[model samples]
Each structure stands twice: as structure tokens, then as C-alpha cells.
Target: MNVAQVRRTSGESIHFDVVENFSPFELGTESFSFSAPVHVQLQVINTNKAVLVSGTIETELKVICGRCLEPFDYPLNLPYQDEWAFPAQATEELLESALLLEKDEVDISQRIFEQLVLALPMKFVCSEECQGLCLTCGANLNQTKCSCKEEVIDPRFAALAKWQAND
Candidate 1:
């Protein structure tokens, strides 16, 4: 993005509408792919000391269910807000969280990538009632019930169970 215009005067602002495609990306151990093009609508404002960029990123993602391990579509509408401080006004706190605008042009690709990563959830479930998989036969319980008999007690606790029953 070209910040030359907005940086020329305080209170000056610009609006941007961007539509682009991104390849599959990984967040920790999970991987995600975009099912649709990413759409971004943003406004950039010059506040003399800093430039404020706020926007929304919309997309549909193909994700795997953490429980059932099935593929599903997850829609994302993420809000993004960040600041770029002028060299003279840059403070320690701002410098740690934001980037310095030393030049007329700024590349926001890194910011966008960070936003996507931060928006990811720790776990993904297809539904609340998902039965997950059978431990003995490794079968999807949601689809079918396995013939293996379930033992509710841990093998290590079997001796304790008998002692408690006697008491």
C-alpha cells in the first residue's frame, strides 16, 4: 500500500478493497485451505503520530473436525486493526506491537498472515453431538457402532475398585 498520500497530512484517509486467493496454510499441527477467495475491505487513516489500518477479512475455509476427523467448511469473518507509527513518535510499546513506517510504501502481507493465524481456534468440531471414534476398533462412532465391549474403568485402577467395594 502507498502511504505517501495519507502521510502527507494529518486526518487524511484512504479506503482499499482487495480480493485475492491464498494457498493452503498450516497453523501449528492443523492445516487449512481456502474454499473461496479472500475479500478485504479496509480504511487507512493518518493520525499524525501513527497510521491506523482497520479492516475485515472474509473467506470460507476447508477444515477437519477435531473429533470425528471429517472435512467441513468453516466460514471466517475476521476483524483486523493495526497501527504503523511514524519514526519520531514510535514508542517501546508501539514498536513491539506495530511496525515503523520509515518509507512511503508499506507491505501488509505479514500483518494479514498474522491475523489469519491468530484467528484460528485451538480445536475444530463438526458438531456438538459428535460421537468421535471408537477406541477399540478405531471406527467412527457417529457413522456406526463397533462390537467391542466398553470398559469404563482404567486397567490400573482395577485393584482400587475392588478395595473400595469391600469398604
Candidate 2:
């Protein structure tokens, strides 16, 4: 999770394969949860004044469907790349654009967590053809059909329905 050795060398590259368990508490999200450990394959390359980190993260997440409110397994394989540049004896403006490295190490856990959060979709569904639920009977339409009348509408939308009928 921390690139300690890369900071010691001027131009060194290191490869790492790590498996770590991440709890839902760490992610701070109630929409999804992880039942197994996540695998990360990373490569850290140290340049003269920068450290380049690149990797792929793989995991399976249990997420709730937004439409049907059902739980389903979602698989993820995301690639991430970033650079942390050390301060050089250059102009102050140039140093402001680069990320300052911590004392002889660069922690990548926060970055990986942020990437996973951003990679998640705003809306989750079990399948593309999911019929969701019936509003009147509160039944899963994908599993069975409901006998409730489909023409029922709120009174607030009665004017719109009349206009739609005229069109």
C-alpha cells in the first residue's frame, strides 16, 4: 500500500501483487458490500523527481438494484494510474501543480479507494431487461404479472392524461 522502496532509489521500478480485505465501513457506503478480498496488481516506477503508480484492481461487490430493490453480485476490474512529483528547485508555480510526496513514502490506499468509489455506477440494476416492481401491488414484475388496473393515475396528472388522449 505504501511505496517505500521506490523513494529510496532515483530510478527504480517495483512490481507488487497484494490481496486485502476491505470492509463496507472503509468504503462508507450502504448501497454495496464486499464479501471477499480485493486483488491489486501494481507497478511503481521512480523517476528523477516523480513516482508513477499504475495498477489494476479486481473485486466482486454485492449491490442492490435501484429499480427492483434486489441484491445482486457485481464484478469490477478497474485500472488506475497516477503520479506524485517531488518538489524541484524550479519556479514556485511549477511546484504548485505537482503533488508533494510524503516523507520517503507514497501511500496508495486512499487513491485506490477513491478510484473504486468513482468507478461505481450511479444506478445499479440486476439486468437490462428487469421489469422492476408494480407500483400498486408492490410485486416484482419480472417474476409475475399483477392484475391491478394499469389505467389508474393520480388526480394531479388527470389534465395531462386528457391532453395526451387528444394528441
Candidate 3:
């Protein structure tokens, strides 16, 4: 079951269980994992050509931290709601497919996955106070301190330091 089927609620008020093992994003990515599963319950309403999709997906996601470039795991509770149009003239077979957009077939799961992928913070700091890697030695500050002096200021500004002493 995909997002489109899940979003399709009958006239009498329908509910669907949405499921997808892999969202197609992990196919060629180096840092993302395909082992995690995605599942959700969608409640939808279709009025004319308009379809409303609302659901919550709770699953485990594996991604490499943008900061340390190390893979990490996170539990996701992704709430999704979107309105789309699959024309009344559209083939019934196509309308039932997941992520079906307007005149053409567009999978909602793909876009939703894109949203989930893009929504992730570009920089994932291990903690709020993460000191990050040492600029000079490329040492992970969270694990160890670098022997290189941090106060090695540029020589061009050396004269500025002595001005404070004279004042």
C-alpha cells in the first residue's frame, strides 16, 4: 500500500493502512539505509477532483549525520497532509495508484519521501554544545582535544595585540 491508496477514503468515510518498506530514496544513496520500514494510517476525503491526504508515519530512519559524516538512527513521526487533483476524467486504474497527481501519474510517496528527505536538518550536531572537529588537525572534538594551539592568530594582525598593552 502506498500514499495514494491510503489517501483514498470512500464516500462513507474510509480509513486505510499505508505501508512501504522502502521509499525509493535509499536506492543509490551512500548514507541512507533501506532496512527501515515506513507505515502510516491515512484518512482521506475526495470531493470532485480534489483529494485530501492526512496521516502520521512512525518509523525508524537511518541517516548519516551531515556534521560528522557518521551514520545515525532516528525514530520518525512524520505527519503528512496534502491536497491533490487527479482529474475526474482520469482512468480509475490510475487514480488508485499511490502519489497520483493531476493529468499525469505522480506518486505521492515519492514526493512525500522527498519531503522527509529534505526536511532533515543539513547539519546534525551530536549535541547543542558540540565543539566540532578541530580545523587544523581534523580531530573530532567530541572525542579528543587537539595538540595544535587554537590561539595561532594570523601574523598580519600581530601589531594589534601589543596596542592593548600600551593603552
Candidate 4:
């Protein structure tokens, strides 16, 4: 558990397998199941002159539609090829390829969670062209139809429309 936190600064390398909880990504939504743990396999490597990391992050989680608020399962496979900069850079890379960093412990959960957040869609819809829900009566536009007429303007913007009417 805590080992992952030290991987970034031990002057050592890390190879770990751990479980994570259902993050906020799996909250009150529709089709997705925000359950299960995240599986991470990583290594910190240092060669002739520099430090490089290589690994694969695997996780199974649910993606929810930002529009319709539906949920769906998504599997992630992110391969990493990155450099860790401590102060300026991991200087130990010149000594051994498999070097442990001795900087302060870098939180592994924060690293992994940040990656997951970046992986999420800005607007996650179950489908590419989700119709979303009707704003009038809260009807799901994809599954049902509503008789209410769609209005383009917000009542708050009524003053802004005076110019349009005058034109």
C-alpha cells in the first residue's frame, strides 16, 4: 500500500499490484458500475545516464454520460514512458538503470488517480451522438418524446433579447 507512495523517491524501482476503491467516477448515475479496484504494474528504470519509467496501468470502471447521465463500463490500458523530475531530475539514473529515488515519498495514489481523471472524457455520453434528456419535463430524448416546446432563451437573458426584437 505505502510502497507505491515511495516508488518515485526511494533511489529504488517499483513493481506493484494493488487494488483501489470505486472513485467518484462511479457515483449516482445510470448505466455504469463504479465498482472494483484499479490494477497498476509499474517500474522505475535508470540506465547509463537518465531515469525512465515503463509500465502498464489496467483498470475496469464505469463511464457515465455527462449529458444523459448514463453509465457504461470502460477498460483502461495506459502504457507509460515518462521521466520523473526530482528537484530537477532523477540524477541517480547515471549510476543504475534500476535506481531508487531518495526524495520525499511521492504519493502513488495521487499519481494514479490523476492519470484516471485525465483519462475521463470531458463529456461522457453513452454514445457518440446522445440525444440527452429534454429540459422541459426531464424526458430522456433517446427513449421518449415530450410535447413541451423547446425554448432557446433563458429567462435570465430576457433583457439581452430586447436588441434582437428591435432589429
Candidate 5:
């Protein structure tokens, strides 16, 4: 959504309610996708040379579990606040962090998408105690166990196993 800087007069605020459906935005890896429509309610307050933008974004994300590699739905309700400075009043350093008002308007869709990306969890898991698949037999450990005996031993740790046997 685009917000016109000129429309927000001094001491006046404008509110917007936007519903946007993205065509499966990629999240992190190609295996995960977010195909939900986002609902945003934004408020822009003009303080003469600067604008304060605050809003809330709500959506359901379809993400792959990093642990079990399962697909699941994750709900998101993110709140964001940002400042926009008019080009004439902004410094070079401030422009890096704050959005710059160019041609009397600012597009906020990109900013919203960026916020959503930042808000995503560092690790995606189906559950806290989820048992991931077995590395040897490729069996879902959460559902069933395999008869494969995993006897992996590092070359450096081979001597340690002999010491334990003597005890």
C-alpha cells in the first residue's frame, strides 16, 4: 500500500486497512513458502516534517518444520512502528533506517514484508519434544522406531571407547 505524504497534514492522522494476498513468498529456503493473505491496519501521523507510521499485521504462515521437515501453519500477529522523514529534512544516516518520502508518497508493502521476514522464528519446529526422523533408516522416530543399529564412532574417539570397556 502507498501512503501519500502530502495527504497527512500537520497534526492529522490517516488510517488504512489493507488486505493483500501474496503469490507464495519464499521464506529462507525454497522448501518453505508463505501463502497467506496479510491483513494490516496502519496509522500515519504527520508531525510536519516527519511521519510516524504504526500498524499491526496478521497472517498465517505455512512453514516447514526445521526439526521433522513437516509442513505446518503458524499464526503471526506482528506490530510495527517506523518513521518517515521528508527528503529535505532527513540526514544521510537517518535515511538508512527510516523510509524517505520521495515524490510525495511512500510504498509500505515492502516494509511490511521485511517486517514479517524479521519476525519469523529462528527455528521452526512442529513441537518442542518432536522426535525427528532417524538418520540411518529415514524412519519417523515420532511414530515408530527402526531396527537399524547406529554404531557411528569417530576415529579420534575410538580410543575412548576402549578405555570405557576396560572399566
Candidate 6:
């Protein structure tokens, strides 16, 4: 991202539409792979003191379903926003907390990566109707039916079950 135009004149803005292919990244034990390049539509605005970058990002990721443990494609579309102080106004604290616009061009790949990671869901499921795996046989219920009988009773609450049955 080149901010020279915006930096030269306060209130000046520039719009960009780009597609980039980023390297794969991991979150804990889960690995995220991109099926295609990420699409970004962004605007850079000079606010006198700081430059604001706001945009929409879209991509398709290959992820394992948290329930079925099967690989599937997940489409993601999200909004992103960030600000960086101009070099003259960039204080020590601002530099540490955010970013400083020092050069004519800025490599926002890191920022985009952070946004994608932050927007990830806690659990990735193929669908809401996903049946998941069978607890007893470790069989994927979505693909096939399991013959293992479900014993849902808790041993600690066995007495309560018997008491309720008597009533």
C-alpha cells in the first residue's frame, strides 16, 4: 500500500482492489490453508494526524471440521480497520501500540494476516447439521450410521435416574 498521495494532502484518500496469495499459517495444532488468493478492497485516508486503512477482505480457506474432523472449504468475508500515525506525530507510545507511516509504501501483509486470524471462529464446522463422530466407535456419523448403543447415563447420577424412574 502506497500512502504518499494521502500523506501529501490531509483528507486525501485512495482506493485499492487487490488479490494476494499468502503463505499458510497455523493456529495451535490446526493448520489453515488458502484455496485461492485473498481479495481485498480498501481505502486509505489521511486524517492529518493519522492514516486510516479500512477495507473488506474475502477468501476461501481449507480447514478441518471441529466436529467431524474432515477437511472442507470455508468461505470468509470480513471488514477490517486500522490506523497509523504520521511520522512527525508518531510518538513512542503510538509506535509501540500501533504503527508509524515512515516510508512511501507500507507492507500490510502482516496486518491482513492478523485480521484473518482474529476473524476465525472458535470452532469450524462443515455445517450446522453436521452429525459429528460417534463417541463409542469413533465413526464419522455424517458418512455412515454407527451400531454402537449410546449409554448416556452418568455413573455418579445413577441413583438419581433410578429414583426418578420409580416416581
Residue 157 Cα positional deviation in candidate 5, in Å, after optimal superposition: 8.8
In the predicted model 6, the residue pairs found to clash are: none
lDDT of 1 by residue, 84-143 (tens): 999999999889987898988888867787788788788878899999987777789899
Give the alpha-carbon lDDT of every model. 0.86, 0.78, 0.61, 0.60, 0.78, 0.89
- TM-score, cand. 2: 0.77
Candidate 3 lDDT (Cα, 0 to 1): 0.61
Q: How close is candidate 5 to the true structure, as a TM-score?
A: 0.76
lDDT of 5 at 33: 50
**Tens digit per residue, CA lDDT, model 6, 14-106:** 998999998898899888899979999999999998898899999999999999999999999999888889879988887776688888889
The candidate, 2 or 3, that scores higher on TM-score is: 2
- True lDDT of residue 146, candidate 1: 81
RMSD (CA, Å), candidate 3 to true, equals 6.1
Models 1 onward score TM values of 0.79, 0.77, 0.61, 0.54, 0.76, 0.84
Q: Of models 4 and 5, which has the larger lDDT?
A: 5
lDDT of 5 by residue, 65-156 (tens): 77778888888899989988877779888788787776555677788888988998888788888888887777788778777745656667
Per-candidate count of clashing residue pairs (backbone under 3 Å): 0, 0, 3, 14, 0, 0
User: Which one wins on lDDT?
Assistant: 6
What are the runs in model 3 whose C-alpha is more than 4 Å off? 1-10, 23-31, 89-107, 149-151, 154-167
lDDT comparison, 1 vs 6, better candidate? 6
Candidate 4 TM-score to native: 0.54
Per-residue CA lDDT of model 2 for 6-119, tens digit only, reads 877888989989898876743455645785678889898888778777889998888888888889888889997877776563346645655667666556677777888899
Off by over 4 Å in 2: 26-31, 88-98, 149-167
Global CA lDDT of candidate 4, please? 0.60
State in Å the error of residue 153, model 2.
6.3
